[model samples]
Target: MEMNSSNLWVFIETNEKGQAHNVGLELLNPGHSLSRAQGDEVVAIVIGQHTEAAVASAEAYGSDRIIIVEGEEYARYSTDAFAYAFHALITKYAPTSILIGATDLGRDLAPRLACRLKTGLTADCTELDFDEESGNIAWTRPAFGGNLMARILCPNHRPQIGTVRPAVFKKPEQDTSHKAEIVREEIHFSIENIRTKLIEEILDADNETIDLEGAEIIVSGGRGVGGPDGFKVIQQLADALGGTVGASRVAVDSGWISSAHQVGQTGKTVRPRIYIACGISGAIQHLAAMSSSDTIIAINTDPEAPIFKIADYGIVGDLFKVIPEFIALIDEQILTMAV
Candidate 1:
C-alpha cells in the first residue's frame, strides 16, 4: 500500500476507559514542533472503543487533526489488530513521520508496525531533531551501554518512525481553546483477523508507583549508599527537593529500592531537569539512563567515581552526612521564603 499524505502522525494510547495517557501528550510536544518546522500538520491516530474523549485530549495537546478508530476489539491492545488498523491508516493518510511512546505496549507494538510497513525504527530515543538541510529526522539514542550516543536516520522510508522514552520530552501545555477537525474512522477488521486471545485482565492494586520518566527532578542512589536504610535519607532528600527517588541497577538488584525507581540501560530512561546522584558510582549502564538531564549533581565519597566525569557538580563526601545537611538547608530555605 502506497501512502500519499505528508503529515506528522502520532499514536495516542488510551486506557480501558478511553482516557488518553500522558505519554501520548508527551510525544505530541515534539510532533507538533516538528510539524511546524516541516511546514506540515500534526495528525494523531487513536484506536479504541469510545475514543471521543481521547480524540478531544489529543486536540487539546496540539494535534491539528485527530483520527479516531473505534471498535470493541481495540479495547485491549492486540499487536496484530493494532498493526493492521494503523497500517491501513498510514496507507490512507501517507504521513511523513510516525512517533510512538517507548512504553511497554509501545515497545511491543512499534517494532511490529515497522515490520509491517517495511521501514526502520529508532527505539528508546533520547533526543529528536529535524535536519533542515536534509528535511529528515535525527534520532539520537545510547549505543554502547550509554557510553556513546548514536544518531539514526531513515533516508529511503517515506514515513520515518521513532519511539521515544517517556518523560524525556516536556508535555505540551494544554491549549483547550485550540480545536482541530476530528475524523471518526471505522475499524473494518473482524475478530477472526485478530491473532491473540484475550485472557483475564488483572489490574494490580499497587499501581501507585512513581513514574520517574515523567518526574521533573530525580534523586537516585547507588552502591555507595551502603544498604536499604540509606534509601531513607535519599527519599527524604527527594521529598525535600519535591522530586522522586531513583536507584541504580545495584540498588535494585540488592533489593534496596523497588525496580520502579531504577534508572539505567535495562531500566527506565529519564531526562529530568535535575538528576542528583547520591553514593552512585556512575556506571555506564546507569549513566545511559540519565546523562541527558539538564543538570546532573553527583555526591560520592570517592573523588574518582565514574559519575563525576559527567556530573556538572561533584561533591566528595559521605551521602549519609551530605544528604541530611542538604535536606536541612532546603527546609530552612523554604521557611525563609515563607517568612
Candidate 2:
C-alpha cells in the first residue's frame, strides 16, 4: 500500500438508513485543516448500500472528494467485509492520514485496518494537528491514568491513523456550493465468504440514565458524591430541571452509579446546552469531555476544586446544602410561574 498524494481521508459511517452519523461529518473540519496544511485533498470513504446521501453530505461538509463502496454485502456492517473493503481502498489510494469515529463498529475496524496497512493507530485521540517540524500527524490523547495528555506521532508511516471519540469536535458548517469528485467502487466481497451473520439488532428501551450523550442539560456528580445514595441527589436536581444525570469516573467506579452515566475522556463526550456539576472534583479527563458545553455551573464545597476554573458560575459551598437549596428554589419558581 504505497501512493503519491498526501490526501487526508475520513470514514463516514452510515446507519441502516444510509444516512451518515454526526461524528463522521463533524470530523471534516479537522480533516480539512490537515489537508490544507499538507497541501492535499480531503476525501471521505463512504462504504454502505444506498450511500448517495452520505456522499452528498461529505461534499457539503467539506470533503474535496468522496469514494463510495456500494454492495448488498455492505448493507450491514460486518467486520470481515468492511475491513477488507477499507484495506482495498487504502492500499490503492494511500491516504496521508485517516480518521475514524470511536464507535463500537469503528473500534473494531480501525485497528484491523491499521494492522493490515502495518501502520500505527492512535485510539481515542482528543486532538489532531499537523506537525510542520516533522511533517507528521500529532495525535493527542489522555494518558497516565487520565492524569495527563500525550501527543504521539508516526513519522515513518505513510498514513497516520487515529480514532476520535464522538462529539469531541463540533460539526463544520455545511456548504452546498462545494461539489466533490464522486468515485464509486463496486464491492466484490460475497456474503457467503463472510463468517458472521447479522441477527436482529436488540434495541434498548430509551431510558434517562443511558442517553447522557443526547442530553441537552446534564447535572453530573463526581467524587464528592459520597456513595450510591449520593447519586440520588444528583438525579433529583436533574429531574427538577428536566435534564439527565451524569457521573464522574470515580463515582461510577465506586459503584455509586452505572458506567453509562459517566462523563469524561474515558466515558461519553458531550456538548450540551448547559452542564451542572455538583460535588465533583474536576479532573482533566472530565473537563476534556464536557468543556464544550455552552454554559457550565460547578457547585463544590472546595473553592480550590479544578471544576470551578472552567465553570461559568461557581458556588463554593457544601453541595449537600447547595443542591437541595437550589432545587427548592427552582421548584418554587416553577410553582410561582404556574400561579
User: What is the C-alpha local distance difference test score of each model?
Assistant: 0.87, 0.88
Model 2 scores a C-alpha lDDT of 0.88
Candidate 1 global TM-score: 0.91
Query: All candidates' TM-scores?
Result: 0.91, 0.84
Q: 1-339 in candidate 2: lDDT tens per residue?
A: 233477899999998899988789988989988888988888899999789888889989988889899998899999999999999998788888999999888899999999989999999888899899999989998777567889999989878999998887877899999888888877569889888987777653434336776778999998888998888888899999989999898998998887888898778899889999988889888988898899999999999999999999989988888899999999999999999
Best by TM-score: 1
lDDT by residue (tens digit), candidate 1, 156-272:
987899998876777899999989877877866787878888778765343466878778899999998788998999999998888999999999999888787889878888889
Single out the weakest 10-residue window by summed lDDT for candidate 2: 201-210
Quality of model 1 by C-alpha lDDT: 0.87
- The C-alpha stretches of model 2 lying farther than 4 A from their native spots are 1-4, 207-211, 214-216, 223-242, 250-259, 302-306, 309-312, 327-339
Clashing pairs in 1: 5-94
TM-score of 2: 0.84
